[model samples]
Target: MSKAIARRGIMLVLSSPSGAGKTTIASRLLEDPGIELSISHTTRPKRKGEKDGKDYHFVDRETFTRLRDQDAFLEWAVVFDNYYGTTRKPVEEALAAGRDVLFDVDWQGARKLRESAKDDVVAVFILPPSAAALEQRLRTRAEDSDDVVKRRMRGASNEIQHWEEYDYVVVNTDIDQSVASVRAILAAERLRRTRLSGLKGFVQTLLATL
Candidate 1:
């Protein structure tokens, strides 16, 4: 008799300081085959090039609060004075369909995910090599006000403090290397025997052939 193919999915989380190359790594990962980005619902103003449902599902504060009250989000966090949440339904559906999800969020969101769905999660924390380098990157971007830059710098220290909590940590010394490292982690995770949901059925079929 052949066994059924188990359904499984991966929750790949990448977190970092404001300029720690996490976003770059995440962008590259999204291009990989069969990887889906977790579209978070947020109560924050969209920046240039950001879009609703693609970048984030922008919503009013009342809507966000209502969802939270209803226990709808798998994970939610308040960052930079903005509310960001990952809805439970879509992630649940994707996992049941055996598609991996990539999450680009901070430590708070990561922790929340772990608490809510530890079985399917694999978190990776990215760090800047040095505070000076991080500051330089922030300044180069020219995206934030001076006050916001300082706020992020302070937030970096707090974010880095939770490095030990993640499943993996990558010091983003080089963009290519960092991306490669994360890719390797993904490859390794995909190889986990338990995650090979259809292998049992295939092996059983092979035995019948023999």
Candidate 2:
């Protein structure tokens, strides 16, 4: 008879500029049942087709401020005048139960998560093939107005500057290839010795049988 070995989960963070395909990659990754998305709480207005609690826990500024004051977030950040935060309770619970949590956050949020939980974090930064391609993606998506798209383009440069801070960098030239690369990273990280809580005991038992 064999015993099931317990494993601890990792915090997989995917950060990128506004049009660099991080969201797309994340969506594909979520198709796996072992990993779950870390749904964030945001003060930003929900976009068309966004469902509350599913996309984000949309709240007003007052509620967000209260939660921040209570230290309810594992990590929080302000981007483009909107507040976004990951709730501590849900993420902690998931990690403890061996369910990996995926984060689609900015550099600031990534920094905070690392600072708080360095051992469990595996940060990956995604980049666009070129500035031209980034702009074209943003325009073609049509999710934002002209002014918003311009602002995002300007912000992309600043975001890309922090690429070196991440553990891995993926240049998203092709969507399927980029996703496969990320999936590989996740697969490798899952085998890291530190995350396997039962390895020592499992090994000891196996040695006894020998």
Candidate 3:
């Protein structure tokens, strides 16, 4: 029996406006052992129940700036008043070992990753079913003030404009359905011929035997 061909892992990027349920989808995707979530380094203070290096690599602003200046990040963006960035080393190592890395970032960060690793990156944009629905979801969370919710609603239009930049778009009408769709995308991408690094050698050996 032939051995399995080794393939490079994908950099799956999930981007959505606040309250669009992208984070929820990402959390569900992380349940699979084959997929690993990229832990971003952030300047924001860690919230309750969030751990260092798990939820995020909480760092000081100066440290974050130093890393950013060193070009150590695959992508970085400023959100609200804090800086967030995905480090390059861990992601490169994971891909080399055939472990897929999932990214939960904004459209700006997604765009940066696309420019840097176009072939390895598979970006998806999640959209809420309707504007009213999105606002309602935000309000229901009760985490943000009314002023912040209003600001988010205003910025959501700009975020939606970048949906065209992503390779896939899923309207998050239902959580389970959307998660299934993303899983399907990951399964299909894994089988892509370009990603299977050992495929050429395997095929050549078979042809030689014939």
Candidate 4:
């Protein structure tokens, strides 16, 4: 009879500037049942059509501050005057059960997560093929005003400066190809020896049987 080997989960962090297709790639990756999004806790007000637990765990500033003081968050950051954090308890539980978690964070948030859980984290940075391509992608959406689009383009430049900090970089010229590349990275990271806690025990059992 064959036994299953238990393994620790991966914290797959994907960071990209606006219009870089990071969210689209993450959506594709979530189709796999083995991985789930790491829903974050935020003090930002819920937007229209956003649900409490689905979009984010919306909490009051007082509660967020309390949790931060207690060290209950695996990583926390202040972005545009709003507090965002990942609670340690649920992620730790999921990892122990061999369930992977995906994080869509900015460069600062990614840095914090790495500091908190260095061993479990795999960070990827997504980029556009060129500045012109990024501007075109943002304009194609037709959802943002001209000023907003310009602001986003400027932000993208600043964000892309941190690309070298990531473990992997994918220049997203084709959506399908970018998704495939990210999927391959996830598959390879899942097989890493350090994540497989049960490998040693499985080997011992096999040796005994042999």
Candidate 5:
């Protein structure tokens, strides 16, 4: 009997402007058994119903700073006056164990991850259909103040500019469709020849048998 070839795990990253449905898509993708979400550390206050080490690893400014100083984060960034970071240790362990890790971060974090782990990173950018639609989604959520919403709208243009940097782009006009597109991307990325770590040995063994 032939042994199965081993493969390395992927670092799947999703990024979008505020209210672009990236978070929703990321949540749905987590249902897949092949990938696990990377729990991020943040200085932002936990919202209602949020759990520690689940939604985010909430930490104080001092703690966050200490981790940052120690180079413990794979990627870290400041957003809306709060520090958010993906820790290095857990993600490294997951990848080493052949478990794909999902990252829901902004473009800055995505760039850093790609730089740090070029071969393992697969980045996707999500975009809202239009400016009007983006604003409408933000208003419908009712989670942010009018002033904050307006600020986000202003920042959206800047965020969209980085879309070309990602490996794939998905327009989030329909949630189900967007999710499907991302799932396809993940499936294809997993099969890339470079990622199949043991393929060379497997092929050599097969050739020997012949």
Candidate 6:
């Protein structure tokens, strides 16, 4: 039997505004064979469809601050004035087990994630086609009040301005097309030569046959 290659898993970070098509993309990516979603810890209220651990781990401000003090977060950020964080242990464990983690966060969290795991992290910024479309999408969520919608739109411009910070920027003009783009990026990253741990031995074995 052939020996399997051992490689550290990729940390795929995807960030967008509250209604910037991130959840849809994130859900689709989690269905992949080698990927796991990092369920973030948040101080925000849970949405109707979200569960305690599935959507986000809802915690009080005190718990969030305590975790931060302990350096438990690989990345943490405050967006729309809500505190959110991703713990280091879960991502570390997944990579050690040869599984990748997908993170849905803002630029604030993405910056910290890159700092912690620069070698293994691939950051992607998802952008809406236009400001009008982004605003329209936020309103369609129906959970937000008009004031909240305005607030989100204001924050979105700031977020979009940081697109160059990402390794990849995907304009979400079409849902299927954008997701396909994300899929392509993941497929390529997984095949990088550095990720194939047993390459030296595999090459040596092939040379012996010659």
TM-score of 4: 0.91
Sorted on TM-score, best first, the list reads 2, 5, 3, 6, 1, 4
Model 1 lDDT on a 0 to 1 scale: 0.91
Task: Please write out the lDDT profile of model 3 over residues 179-205, one tens digit for every residue.
Answer: 999999999999999999989999998
Q: Model-by-model lDDT, in order?
A: 0.91, 0.95, 0.94, 0.91, 0.93, 0.88
Q: Candidate 1 on 79-160: residue-level lDDT in tens?
A: 9889999999989998888889999999999999999999899999999989999999999989899998999999999999
Per-residue lDDT of 92 in model 5: 88
In candidate 1, which residue pairs get closer than 3 Å at backbone N, Cα or C atoms, i.e. clash? none
Which structure among the candidates has the greatest lDDT?
A: 2
Q: In candidate 3, which residue ranges exceed 4 Å CA deviation?
A: 1-3
- Most accurate candidate by TM-score: 2
lDDT agreement of model 2 with the native: 0.95
lDDT of 3: 0.94
Q: Which structure is stronger by TM-score: 2 or 5?
A: 2
Q: On a 0 to 100 scale, what is the lDDT of residue 190 in model 6?
A: 81
Q: Which stretches of candidate 5 lie over 4 Å from their true place?
A: 1-3
lDDT of 6 at 106: 90
Model 2 lDDT per residue over 98-119, tens place: 9999999999999999998899
Please write out the lDDT profile of model 4 over residues 1-210, one tens digit for every residue. 133888899999999998899988998999988999999999988867689998799999999999999999999988657899998999999999999999988898899999999999999999999999999999998877899799889889789999999999999999999999998998899888888889989999889999
Off by over 4 Å in 4: 1-3, 45-49
Question: Model 6, stretches more than 4 Å misplaced?
Answer: 1-3
Tens-digit lDDT track for model 6 on 1-210?
243766768999998876879889989988778898899999999988889998899999999999999999998888767899998898899998878899998988898888898989888899998888998899888999999999888888888888899999998999889899999999898877787666778878789999
Clashes, model 4: 0
Clashes of each: 0, 0, 0, 0, 0, 0
